[model samples]
Target: MLGSAGRLIRAVVDFALPALCALCGRRLAEDEVAVCMECLTRLAPACAPFCRLCARPGPRPCGWRGGLCSICADHGRQFERHRAYGLFEGDLARAIRLLKYSHRRSLAQPLGVLQARVVRADYILRQAEIVVPVPLHRTRRRDRGYNQSELLAQAVADLTGRSCTPRILRRRRATRTQTKLTQDERLANVRGAFWVGDPGEVSGRSVLLVDDVFTTGATLDACAAALLEAGARSVAAVTVAVAPAPPTGRGRT
Candidate 1:
């Protein structure tokens, strides 16, 4: 069809002229990927000594005995484990904001590929049989025209040779944004907000939940809880970034 041919031509053009860096708008060099080498080096890599349960930076190396953090120890999380590519700060955070809020869906592919690399290196993600992105409410999806998480999930699935099920989970109710809320408030807002479209799709399977950012862990917990309730054997989380815990209080790990 002519439409299909047009699409193919567009794809070729895009491949020929990849967009510039979302942060700096600089043309990437031949040796560079989505981001230039300078920006990539500036984005701090997450080091170890993180919580085995949630991947948040911790005070000391986790022991295999429990491998849990204070938050996980005090309040058990529904998700089995979590991992992220970097801390939510500097250029990484700015890039994510552009992708999520600025309607730059093209950025998802490169970021998702980066996340896939991180997940592959982590043992928890390697064990997952399926990947499911956190769903957006219908209203939000309509406004945004695309789900950033789903885009990331698709890229990750392609890179890892895994299945990306964007619709296995659905947002059952629209809730207020979590950005302005306290930790407990955020949990309350998302509680009972998600539902499984087909429980059998994930029955007895290990799932990797994908999201753009990990702030309070409330959103991931809510999604993981729904998946477990729908018969997923276990759920691990992978995010592009994890925001540093606030200074006054501890963070969920």
Candidate 2:
């Protein structure tokens, strides 16, 4: 009786005050969730002609050499491979901002479904034994009352049926925002900021790291470094979006 009444009430409320698309603010269809179909179609996937290791799009002719971008070739990456669903721009970027800043936690589900598809479709990524999110510092997590990366990791793990070990990694310190920082500064800020809780949990296991975005990759690299140091067999990453590469910046592992 209560279930039926709840459903009826929800239906009436939805009819009277229809939910709008998170990105474009269009009225959502009965079957639609947070975002409408048109905005979903506009969310572009990160297409190829990108670096195989880091998934960064580059110039057509000479952007790669031996399947690696110049930065990957020279510096090497801690994570064996990384993938992004889309470039951080347009509606995709807007959606991410809404989730991260405006506390639109529900958006994590669809974003993570996109990430799970990436993992399922890639042979190498599908081999991961465990999933770990880039951890937020204790203070930050307290302030936000949630960790966006953990939400994403849980969703991916649920869809992929992989073990989500969010507690395996820890951020030992809080760093300032990376938004306006240079690549070097970003790297320095996150270096030594992450650690593994139990080496045994990751020993000889492949780890898939989840995060919201990839900028210079400093944070991901820091997390990967801690995982590798703790005896994880390998590390790879997936993010919802990848920021455009800086003009003079190089990749980090």
Identify the candidate with maximal TM-score: 2
Residue clash pairs of candidate 2 = none
**Tens digits of per-residue lDDT for model 2 on 130-183?**
999999888778666678999999999999999999999998888988877777
lDDT string for model 1 (167-209, tens) is 9999999988877677777788899999999999999999999
Where in model 1 is the C-alpha error above 4 Å?
1-18, 29-34, 58-67, 248-253
**Off by more than 4 A, model 2:** 1-18, 29-31, 60-63, 248-253
On a 0 to 1 TM-score scale, where does candidate 2 land against the true structure?
0.87
Task: Score every model by TM-score.
Answer: 0.85, 0.87
